[model samples]
Target chain A: MNKHKITGFQYFTVFFFLLNSFIPFLGFHKITMISNQDALFSIIIGSILMIGFTFLIKRLYFYLPNKTLFEKIKFLFPKGFFFILGILFLLSSCILLFVTQEFTSFIHFYLLPEVHQFLITLPFLLLIFYFLRKEQEVIFRTSEICFYFYILFFIISMFGILPQSNFLKIKPLFSTSISSILRSSLYFFLSFPLPLFLLLYFPKNSLKRKEGGQKTWIKSILFSGIFLFVTLFLILSSLGVQLTNLYKNPLMVTYQKISFLNILERVEATLSFSYVLLYFFPMVLLIYLLKELILYAFSLSPNYEDLVLLLLLIGNLLGNQFFSFHTNFYFSISIFLAVFLIFLSFYSFLKKE
Target chain B: MKKTKLLFIFTLLLLFTGCSSYTELNKLGIVSLLGIDYKDEEYHLYINVVEGEQDDGSLQKEYITYDATGESIDEALHFLYLKSNKKIYLSHMDVLVLSEDVINSKLQEIINYLLNHPEIRNNFELVELSSPMNILFEEKIDSKEISDLIQMNQEYMGTSFSVTFEHFLEDILIDKNSYLPLISFDKNLEINGISLLKNLKILDTLSTEETVLFNLLQNNINQAIYKNTTIVKNETNIEIKKNQITFHLKTEINKNSNKFKENLQKDLRKILIYYQDQDYDLLKLKYKMKQNHLSSLEDSNVLFPKTSLKFDIKISYTNSYLERRISK
Candidate 1:
């Protein structure tokens, strides 16, 4: 096995992009639909709850300092560990398929309207397979390099979009019911930071400096939460509640309105390409997570890595073709996965492995 | 190893060619303007395409117009596509004109088509056309000329306003009402006024003078002439109470400030009452009341026409330097 560990900053970038990749495409639309004008408040409350849950995960990490989540499960429930692994394996596969479908649909709608869907999906799957052939450290390093470009384009797009926003569009605050806001907050909690639980596949000792891993985790969650909050606020203000709810991709439509100095018009595609960059890291990481899950379940050695990756590539292609999943389906599965992971963490804590 | 390297290079070259969606620029008919008209169960479509050619080692640009008619907009576009040698491209279209009939009967269908079409952008200027075929077929007048006319008039006279597809849709969705600038060809193409719309249908056309007043009430004026007095700035605010709505209009004028202020206040009141009598919430008073949380009635439509009106008009003299009149 390749022996390479990641730095605290690499871990930070990986978790940051992982938590934020879904906001522009899926999270913002669902949250806005549920809470209407009160989506901003939902994001805020959701961030607080996410931070609290991160603390619980941080506490669980102390019980087994250098053990991956799979190892801990094996140690805690030796008899029923395979059953738990089976559930995780199914959940990860489902998420992988859903994300692949969404990415393909986004590419079809925005970038390549005339291209066939399978052609669009084939290249991405091959890319994932190519990347999976390497050690997991490559994914983190890739995120570190892409993070700077992501920030630069993000700031430029914000400058283009901020001036055109009308604050009056967000008027009549507190119009939605308290229950609706809380329910939307729960959706936000489940959709955004809950995916960070997947990072437990990399144990604490995977970092070169293990002293401040928790601090890094909290920082990434905060940064991602603030990013989501600002995006929702801008979308609501620029495209009022009615228009925001009308379009399927409100953020991209809002990006269509970005005009800088009237000379830099029609740069929406260039700006929105940053979303593709943000989405790539999480996708690669999820594939890596699935690879680890399969190896642990089947008790296979590292020699079978290439074969496993090839099988996964074919599986993703077939899954995307045969299944038509909606955003709500993905959200429901995410909630289920988060609950299962939470139960696993508590079981490990009780057993104190 | 050499053969493997060559195969990899060939595969990379294939990827660089843009795969299945690739098309040559010469094969596209770039549309810069589109016009729609409905008559006798047929939809008429007019398009202006930008064509370029090389003449004596220099490229020259030309604007061409094509017309087609069918039972539906898509069918009309399909026929146009068949007529043209190149594929129709609409991403760069600048202006879309609709006749009064199209605005009256086919707006919802048009909106659904525009929203569903992927190649259409929302930045194009929208206008209502009078004698659309006459103006559309005028070879000398292209999209640039039409866009420039509306923009220049908006900046200089304030008799017209430029409405984009995005804002038009938003207004309809939020308030169920909107307006489009009216363009007509009388001797030449001229922006006459604005056409008022309610629930996706044209209700009436406001005269140039009434359009200036409407712009004033909505605080969308840069410079306009009201009663021969030049208005340079306008700041309007609407406040809603239990049983009344108040308009706080602050204006800056260049000349004849006092007389212009009185005339403007009188005309403003007359126009408000006129619209109120017509039961047309021209100023979006119903939306404003709901936005301000001032409407207690479950059905706010009943309260809109019955509410009392109040006006506070403030005028400041901008052209008078040193507090002394230069003329008069």
Candidate 2:
């Protein structure tokens, strides 16, 4: 299979991957810390701000057809500049993979206490590794399948959770200080849609006719935005502000509470399975991007599966080893890396032909 | 074709086969009910483990109560784990009974343990135990029945309301004032009333009548019969069907209808206002406040009696009940 072009649904699958990876993991605690009751408002504002950036990336994507932005950097920029940018991109992807592994470790801590962290993550990493090696269509199709599972879990969450929510917990809305709202909104802009920047690396022409257009960005943003909004609102209303801050993973906390008539207990374990399944797509995509970056940086041959394997193994080991030290600057570093990628995207678009 | 065949087998093996350790059922101590009592600066943990099997190819549940004491609930559980030959599993735990002493000063400690333990499911119903642990855990008394009683109270009883660990956590996070259905042992188990807790300490308890009123304020009452006085005592059966209330009042007095309803409202209002003045928001009235009342959340340190609740009294006299009373 030539395995180049992906349909609009596949493109949306990428959006779902980005959405599932971040919402409950990254934004839950940070939003509560910054805005408290004003979180939903701040998220809306932050999403609007992020959509503006995605629009700019869309403009840049169409600027040069049949070429990935990374390829554009290689073709247009000087050799030294391309080499440095490629290495930086690979480093950022590794950092992100490590950060995601920290959340995986949490799942181990809470759900699989009897199992070793390595054992918990090993199968997950291996599955993603297999996904990374498949034809692009297979990867896309698999993600499209997992997208349905995500929707199923999402519906379960809605029916399982919404009635239990105390709407009064969302009181004093729009009452947070201006500084707090702004700070949270800024946090949202920095973390979310940053990972979406990785989509820029996919060969633009790989998108089938009618894919990778204005509608793609709009649909991606709308789906992700509505999902984020509902999930965040449910967390805030269900857990409230104080308890939201108390749990490291409030979404998991909310999931564990999904019992109807005392029979539907332990749904978190099931939902966690869905979450880990959905997370594989983005993780594999990031690893694939990192491998390509490394190849482009070193002028290596295409047959470098060993290199991807080496990178993933070393990344997983280091992620588990330096777990505690990574927590302090995890968000800040992600934001910085995202901002850097955006800058590169804009520079490629703006440079004289 | 050869490559595709190999890949298919590989994927199937990975997907369907084993990756981690799996424990057999007989090798685990499955806890069905847990009781915590704090005394003399130490935490006492009691667990009711369901044990044994039958020859009928079915498992027979035998409640075996085990007790352990330590500096913390975690330490206590650690001791329990070590003492047992089988690994203790709490996933099937249905009820958590906390002694009054445990509720008073050790609630924070208990909550911390509950939050940390992955084995402890959040659906456990919490109740108060005034009886000694030894008596409560006696082999004669079925420990499992207590949890069933709690379920009954939550689903059917009108005079009390039950709080799950999830609800308690949510309430504590929001206001630190909440209520739990109280179960007491007086030779036999009984749903006493509801305990009003502030900052996890038992501030006071509502009588059975008061709990019904509390349920009314919370809109949690399904069907309840309440007796209150208005120059004469009347037993009224109240049922809330689809947001509308239908009450059958049986009064034996030739009293003015408006005054009788007014007295009922007065009694309800008095209890609510009294609790509000004490800053024990048992009804979560603060939670029900609109956006304009948000200032109360910020100035929570200052105790201001909530006076926003209004009562509109409507009465319908049933001809049959009226005639029966008149004949009497």
DockQ of each: 0.45, 0.31
Which regions in candidate 1 have their CA more than 4 angstroms from the true location? A1-4, A211-213, B1-19, B54-58, B138-140, B240-242, B254-259, B296-302, B317-328
- Which of the numbered candidates is closest to the native, going by highest DockQ? 1
Score each candidate by Cα lDDT: 0.80, 0.69
DockQ of 2: 0.31
Q: Which candidate is the best by lDDT?
A: 1
Candidate 1 chain B least-lDDT 10 residues: B9-18
- Lowest lDDT block of 10, candidate 1 chain A: A191-200
- How badly does each model clash, as a count of residue pairs? 0, 0
lDDT of 1 by residue, A1-353 (tens): 33337888888888888878667436577777888889889888987887787766665666576778788888888999899888778877887787888888887887778888888877766677767777888888888888898889888978988999998988767777899899888888876533566777777777785543678878987898888788878888898888888887887887888988988887878887778875677678778888888998898999988788878878988898898777777778767766766676676667854
lDDT of 2 by residue, B254-327 (tens): 33355656666787778866876787766554454423443445453342353454565454443456778998
Interface RMSD of each: 2.9, 4.1
